[model samples]
Target chain A: GQQVMQIPQYQHVQEGEDFTTYCNSSTTLSNIQWYKQRPGGHPVFLIQLVKSGEVKKQKRLTFQFGEAKKNSSLHITATQTTDVGTYFCAGFDAGNNRKLIWGLGTSLAVNP
Target chain B: SQTIHQWPATLVQPVGSPLSLECTVEGTSNPNLYWYRQAAGRGLQLLFYSVGIGQISSEVPQNLSASRPQDRQFILSSKKLLLSDSGFYLCAWSTESYNEQFFGPGTRLTVL
Candidate 1:
């Protein structure tokens, strides 16, 4: 089974601050997907990075897949209160029925 | 827009009680389904996944089980619950050709 480890288990920032979370996997992933879960809410899909070194952005959120395909990052710029939540990175290891290995996640707290 | 539904938005049960949570997908067919659990202050953990009806796969050995009775319906059940089972349970679905998984509103379960 593949394992993905995420760094900075928690983050707190001012409304106009920037934040980022990193995820690393033990094996190369077929693809990586990012998700955000607001407090007391379910996880929601944010974006996916398939190609090596791929980068995608949604409004103020940026996602990046490491060139090695074994790591990824999510960066949020000029964060707001609405950005408070746990950000998780999931990677699929096609080897075992294509099961997903998810990062524990970074819980973000934005102060207004 | 596609919608995924989970019932009993919140539940409270006692030890040894039976547990059941249902999840269903709409606007999609034969999509991959997944069951995950998130403990407070923790990342999401994969419990089970299915690629098709009656093709359930367990990610971890636990007190819970899952079944897919229909093309779009997935169920998570436990005959006897444990205090450790208290957490937020989430269901998700995705296409076979893609890696982005869309999650349903989670069920908050508390074992009292």
Candidate 2:
């Protein structure tokens, strides 16, 4: 079975600080997707990376996919109170297209 | 424009009670549907997915079962609920297996 491991199960950072969460897969991935779930809300799709060693950015948030396609990271700069939420990364195995292997996710808490 | 709908934003059920949650997608044809559960302060756990009507794949074996009677309709049911069944259940739809998913608002289940 394919598995995705995420680091820093929980993080608490003050406003204006930076935060990063990493995701690693046990096998090669066809693609990786990132999502954010605000408090009391459902998960919302943020971004997806397909090319190896690709990087994408959305305002203060940066996402990078490893050259091996087995690891990914999300970094947020100058966190705000609105940035408080749980971030999840899901990966699709190159050999398995039926389902996406999901990480346990990283919970981010920002203090104002 | 696409939308996903989930009924009963919140539910409270006693142990041993039967459970049913429904999800539907609008403005999309033959979309891939998925059911996921997330315990408090935990990560997402995939329960089931459907590629089309009557086509379902279970990710984890539990007391839960899923059905897709219609192309865009997915249902999660349990014969008898347990205390561990309590969680945030989310329904998502994707255009393809490797595409980003659109999630419903989700249903909060509290088993007593």
The prediction achieving the highest DockQ against the true structure is: 2
- Cα error, residue B40 of model 2, in Å, equals 0.7
lDDT of model 2 at residue A86?
92
fnat, candidate 2? 0.82
Task: Report the C-alpha displacement of residue A88, candidate 1, in angstroms.
Answer: 0.4
Give the poorly placed runs of model 2, Cα more than 4 Å off: none
Compute the interface RMSD for each candidate structure: 2.0, 0.7
DockQ for model 1? 0.66
Give the CAPRI class of candidate 2: high
C-alpha TM-score for every candidate? 0.95, 0.98
Give lDDT for model 1: 0.90
lDDT tens readout by residue for model 2, B1-112: 9999998899999999999999999998999999999999889998999899999999888999999998889999999999999999999999999999999999999999
Model 1 agreement with the true structure over B1-112: per-residue lDDT tens digits: 6899999899999999999999999998899999999888898888998999899989789999999999999999999999999999999998973568888988999998
Candidate 1 on A30-96: residue-level lDDT in tens?
8988888888888888888889999998899889998989899999999999999999988887565
Best by lDDT: 2
Could you give candidate 2's per-residue lDDT for residues A1-112 as a string of tens digits? 7899999999999999999999999999999999999999999999999999999999999999999999999999999999999999999999987788889989999989
